[model samples]
Every structure is written in C-alpha cells, then in structure tokens.
Target: MGSSKAPSWSDQWGTGGLGSDNYEYEEGDKLKKSSSSNKMSSAKAAASAGMDKAKSAALVSADKAKSAAVVGAQKVKTGTFAGLKWFKNQYQKRSSK
Candidate 1:
C-alpha cells in the first residue's frame, strides 16, 4: 500500500481502503472528541452489532417459516382435492360395471 499522498492499488480498482486526507483524523484526536457517534464504547458497539445480527437472523427465519407454511397449505389443499377426485372416478367406474 502506498501513502495516502500517493495513489495505491485500492484506488486503482476503486475500493479505497487507503486512509484519510485530513491531518486531525490521521492523528485520531479530533473526531472522538467532536462527534456524538464516536462516544460509544467498544463493548457497547459490539453488543449493538450482535443484537442487530440476531434480529436480522430472526426475521429471516420467520420469513422462511411463513413461506414453508404457505407451501404446505397449498400442497394439503391440492392433495385433498386430488384424492377426492380419484375416489369419485373409481366409484363411478364400479357403479357402471
């Protein structure tokens, strides 16, 4: 990786992992004191991220369960109607014979 002053491999492909432009941000002295968002502790940040991940996983599971239930209901309805139709056809043939 080249210095931020010099363009690097990241910038060549447009990924931009290279560090900041300003001197204060590079020093890490300005943003923490200035911004409210930067005040969160590392532990709190990790916990919040974990909660967010769990919430996302739960929602995805709920969506999958709902979809599965719908498919199951459709299958049951179709199967029941098909069974009834087959029974009626067999009964009709037997009566004609």
Candidate 2:
C-alpha cells in the first residue's frame, strides 16, 4: 500500500497563501489605486489655483482700462473748452472787422 501523509499549510492555501504570487499582486493593485487618487487630487488643486490667478489678472486689467478711459475723457473735455474759446475770439475779431 502507498504511504499517507498530511498536506502542508501552503498546499492547503494554494494560490491564497500569504507569501504567494497572488498576495503580492493584490498588494500592488492596491498601491496603484492609492497613487492614482493622489495624482488626481494634485491635478485638481493645480487647476483651481490657475483659475484663481486668471481671475485676478482679469480684474486688474479691467481696473486699468477704466482708469485709462477716465483720463481720456478728461483730456477730451479740456480740449473742447479750449477750442470753444478760440472760436469765440475769432468771431469777435470778425465782427469788429
């Protein structure tokens, strides 16, 4: 008759053994998932910061444009008054002549 022997723990656990290839594969998969989430969070934060900077730049540009427009309007008002004075003096001279 053939001899009988008990199976070892590794034989019983088969692919699910603690130090087996399956265990390492599962651990690697978990690590990959964690790293992927970390990268996504980092990307989102960078995008948010970029948007804030763009908004601040746009607000500054708008303020500068408003100031320029006010200055231009003041110049136009001054020029118009000077022209009116010159026209009045010419008219007076013509009448006297």
Q: What lDDT tens digits, residue by residue, belong to model 1 across residues 2-89? A: 4345434554334323243211233532222133344446658989999999999999999999999999999999999999999999
Residues 41-73, candidate 2, lDDT per residue (tens digit)? 888899999999999999999999999999999
Off-target runs (Cα >4 Å) in candidate 2 are 1-36
- Candidate 2 least-lDDT 10 residues: 25-34
In candidate 1, the residue pairs with backbone N, CA or C atoms under 3 Å apart (3 or more residues apart, or in different chains) clash, namely none
* After superposition, candidate 1 runs with Cα above 4 Å error: 1-40
How close to the true structure is residue 17 of candidate 2, measured as C-alpha lDDT? Answer: 49
Q: Global lDDT for candidate 2?
A: 0.70
> Residue 54 in model 1: shift from native, Å?
0.8
Error of 2 at 97 (Å): 2.7
Give RMSD to native, each candidate. 7.9, 14.6
In angstroms, how far off is 3's CA in candidate 2? 45
- Candidate 2 differs from the real structure by a C-alpha RMSD in angstroms, to one decimal, of 14.6
| Cα error of candidate 2 at position 22, Å | 24
